[model samples]
Target chain A: MKALVWHGKEDIRYDTVSDPAIEHPRDAIIKVTSCAICGSDLHLFHNLVPAMLPGDIMGHETMGEVVEVGSDAKGSLKKGDRVVIPFTIQCGECDQCRRGNFSVCERTNRKKALGDKAFGHATAGLFGYTHLTGGYPGGQAEYLRVPFADTTHIKVPGGIDDEKLLFLSDIQPGDTVAVWGCGPVGQMTIRSAILLGAEQVIAIDHLPERLSMAAAAGAITIDFMQESVVDRLNALTDGKGPHKCIDAVGTESHVDFGQPDTVLDRAKQMLMAENDRPHVLREMIYVCRPGGVISIIGVYLGLVDKIPMGQAMNKGLTFRMAQAHVPRWTGDLLRRIEDGQIDPSFVITHKVDLSKGPEMYATFRDKADGCVKVMLQP
Target chain B: MPLTNVTGVARSEGDPRVQRKGPSSLTGPDRLARALGWFSVGLGLAELAAPGRLARALGLDDKEGLIRAYGARELASAVPTLSIDKPIGLAARIGGDALDLATLAPALHRDNPKRHNAAIAAALVAGITLLDIAAFKGVKAAHRRDGGAARDYSDRSGLPRGAAASRGLARKDFDIPPDYRAEGTVADAIPALPS
Candidate 1:
């Protein structure tokens, strides 16, 4: 099978790898139909997140048809079922899953010890993520072996495409979302917010093309390069800020301001003095309303320096963050797509074969050629 | 060891034949302790693999060897926590936490170049140590409740024949079909279905 393999910092290769087979009773084999390069993938591409060995398969966002199912998986999933695989692998029977905190499912993370050591707790296994989570082979390949298939993958109904349902795992309805970073996830978040009945959506980014795309999705776009984000958001929300602030940009957030802290963060990041540049997180804290929910879908690996916790606590803010629990939202999102509530394909600016993964990763990471999202057809 | 003839059937938690051992399988604190055990292992490996990188990230690059040594200690602490069924391993972790704090005390000084980063790292370690203590207390309470008879099953073999043998039960084996069912015609079948 042809797949994207991670070699090192800024290096991804399209290589032929062995086809995946069902290794567990709850596993299923899927023939991938569509996959997308995620912004979080750039973290791996740049070698920011540790534990990524050479030849680890890369990619998480995917939809496909089930070609095989283990006996235990037959109870819920069947061969020939079209499904959307979530990034987080969950065993629905775990205590966390029962409580709807599927992203931290206790049973799925094979490298639980490592995850616990790094993050204070083991995260649920994530596809294509490094060994911090279980090093599950990713979906950016011709075929994928999905573990905990009965509970992890959502069955998409007929007459709906993968693009329309892909973003359902990230966004929810009734959220006044303020998204930072107008990348692929940011754009989809904009569309998903609107579809989910968010009264107002604020999209922040420096890129003209991405802001324009956000505007097209009925969001109020803020160019961080041109204006002060905190001021704009305050003025727009009558000094209360949005109800929910989404950090779509993760650890590698670009800082448009020349503030000393921002400069230090960037310099430290460059010199490997720090693993993350949390400019967006700080801005979100400054811009979020009192009692607002800060939802972080962004991928942050290590400890961040100097977050404004005092202000967050004094203002009574709620912080919720995790790798998206894809299955939790996939079923409903698929239904929404089938009902014509959203068309997620609008975010795709580049569509190429699996062989172009290497070049496309660079293009996407650099935000070159107005590329917002790249869809890889394997 | 196989104690029943039913090979493929999923074992229910309520099954009386299966003896409950180790940490309470479903309690919040037990789960947390297990997770902490894993975390210690993971962090230890990272420290051992690239002490220089870990030092740099923590703004203590000058103490690379110390970081590597701490990683070794972490790995040592993690094994007992992960492998042992007793609360003693968690207690050891609390001791390890104190050592870490003492090691990090120098980095907290105002004169340190990366004092802010070091402080953050220390705060994180402190928070984890608190969790370790909480988990330790929970495990201790559970241990007392179980009358200190919670057998350490960590060293048990692939099959548990001793318990069944003591009860005069004969082990039975049965053939179970592998779960995977492959369908080569899925793509063709999908296209043939009516939209």
Candidate 2:
């Protein structure tokens, strides 16, 4: 099987690897049909996520056909079934899963102790993520072994294309969502927000191409480089700011100008003293309206420095953030896709074979050639 | 007597009553115990493979021996649970969890340099302990309900009922023609469908 294997910082190799097999009874094997490079993958590419080992497969956003099913998974999945495997692996029977918090599932994280030591708690196993989650070999390969398949994958309805149903793993309707960083997730967040009937969607980014993509998705774009993001957001929403703000940019946020804290954060990051540069988080806190919700779809690993918690507290803000519990939203999102509400494929700027993964990672990370999302076909 | 459908949906195709005997004659909690059995094996391997690294990562480099001993215990606990269909192995796991908590207690002291790491590790162990106890109780309850019927298959459904029923939607709702290329430029792959 060919896969995008992580070697080190900025070193991803499209290499031949061992084919995945069903390791557990509840596992299923999926021959990947479509996989996309995500902004968070850059975290691994840049060596920001600590527990990432050499030769770890990269990629999470994917959909495929079930090539094989284990005994336990046979109840919900079968060979030849087309399914969208969520990045977060969950055993649906767990207490957390019963409550729809699949990202905190107890049974999925095989390396719970590492997570416990790092984040004070173990998160659910995330495909292709670092050891902080379970180092489940990711979906960037030709075939992926999905654990807890009965609960982890959502069967995609036949008429709906992968393009339309891909973003269903994230984003819900009627959320007055404001997304920061117009990367792939951010662009999907924009499109999903519009489809979900969000009254308003504000997109913040410095890139021209990404902002244009957000505008194409019916969101109000803000070029953070040219203007004060806080001021623009306030002015756009009649001084109230957006009802919900999303930090689509995670730990690897970049700031061009040398603001004191951001400069210090950059210095710390360069010195290997801090793993996260939380500029987006701080900005979201400052720009979001009082009592507004802050939803983070961005990936934050290890410790984050200098969050404005006092202000967040004073404003009575509600924070909701996690790795998308892909299964939780898959059903409704697929239904929406079938209903012809939104098309997620609009975000894909480049599509290449699995072999182009190395080059595409750099292209997406560098925001080169107007690339917003790159879909890899194996 | 057992359901053998591809989707595993035929709950006892031959004898519906047998489905009620519970998964593998083991209760729901016992299944959880079996899961923990595998978890112990994974954890044990990590500990045994690199005790010093694990110890340092946990801020307890000085306790490498203790960590290795705990690893050995985890390996020991995993054996009976994996080999037998009894609840006693799960019960032993609960006991081992208690010992683990006791061992982790010292690291929770405010004065300890590694208190934060120790606290997190202890909390994790405590959580595992609670789960072990819950599985034990579940197994016992199932045993009482069935009057000790020794079944060969588990009764619990692996997938949610709603999700299972909707599984056919993939084949029913949309179809990607065999020749359809999902790759290349997004504009070329999926042209604007008539709105």
Candidate 3:
């Protein structure tokens, strides 16, 4: 099998690897048909997250037909079942899973001791993330071995295309909501807010293409490079600030001369003094209306420098964040897709063979050639 | 053994292992930059640990302190060179090369006892200087953004229904999950005080 492997910082390789087989009673092997290069994968590409050893396969957004199912998983999954594998792996029997906090579901991290040392408590195992999250080989290959397959997979219908079904594992909107970042996840968030009845959705980003796509979703766009986000957001909201703010850009905020703080954050990041750049978080706290909500959907790897907790406390803000409780909403979103309410395929700007996954990582990271989201076929 | 075999204690017998390596995301220039960065570390350590030996060999016995300072400079340049920001470190190396040549010029004089050794060191520095220049330019060119305008994606709304028609469409069947609601309905539910 051929898979994209993480070699080191800024080094991904399309390498031939041994085939995966069912290793546990609940495991299932799938012949992967589709996968994606997520924005968060850039973190691994840049070697920001720790515990990423060489030869680890790289991908999370994946869907495919099951070729083999272990004894325990045969009840819920079987051969020829098409399913979307969520990024976060859960046991579905833990107390956390019972309460719908699937991202923190217990009993999944194969390397729990290492995960506990790094994160205080081990969370759910994630496909292709790092050793701290199970060190499972990712789905950026011809086949993948899914653990806890009976509960971890989202069974999808055969008729729909892979693109529409893939983002289920990866939104709510409020009135006068402002979303930071306009990548694929951000773009989906924009449409979700509009569909959920937000009177106005403001999208923030520097890329013209991202801004334009947001506008097509009827969102008013803010090019952070061209104008002041704080000023424009306030003016749009009649000086009261937005009722809610969504952060889709996490950790690696764009380092630009305009956002001098981002420049400093990048310097600290290079020096190994900081793990995350919280420029977006800082701005969201500053610009959100008092008593409003702040939703974080972006993936932050570890510690962040200089967050304004004082302002959030004074304003009585509510912060909601997690790796998606995939099964909790995937079913609902799939129905919506069936009903023609939303289509997620629009976010894919590039589609190529799995062999080209290495170069696509570079292209997507640089945001060059007008590339936005990349979908890879294995 | 493959790297995975050594580090993959967590992996099971059935898990995938590397069979053959292929092309990497790192370009030729990026690999060159990394090699030079490691070279900088080696040279820097030698200069710092044995400045007296280096000075005596080059007939700069009186300039031990200066040689030590150059060692510190080499180590400093190596940091950025080894980092994702290679151009900065490469530029610094180019500057340091000029300094090395200037310091070695007087050592090449006919009267100097180690004039022959100084010539050899000077030639090495000149060779490194050319490699530094090439790596610097190659890195800059390889990582540069496309010179074309960004493609516009205004036609992609992702909403099958028009944006206006889709607003509040899900509200008919869905409500905000109780724990997720920000503005509390509990506050509104309470009777207001008489005005």
What's the i-RMS of each model? 30.2, 26.4, 3.9
Give candidate 2's TM-score: 0.64
Indicate the docking level reached by candidate 3. Answer: acceptable
Clashes of each: 8, 12, 0
As for candidate 1, its clashing pairs are A71-B179, A113-B38, A113-B39, A114-B42, A116-B39, A117-B39, B1-B159, B1-B160
lDDT of 1 by residue, A191-229 (tens): 556654566788898777667667765678898777888
The DockQ values of the predictions, listed in order, are 0.01, 0.01, 0.48
Ranked candidates, highest lDDT first: 3, 1, 2
Correct interface contacts retained, every candidate: 0.00, 0.00, 0.67
- Please, what are the lDDT tens digits per residue for candidate 3 over residues A274-368? 98889999999999887777889998988788899999888767788888888888888999999999999999989899999999998898788
Sliding window of 10 residues with minimal summed lDDT for model 2 chain B: B14-23
TM-score of each: 0.64, 0.64, 0.93
lDDT of candidate model 3 versus the reference: 0.88
DockQ of 3: 0.48
Best by TM-score: 3
lDDT of 2 by residue, B122-182 (tens): 9999899889888878766544422111211112111122222322323333333332222
Overlapping backbone residue pairs in candidate 1 total 8
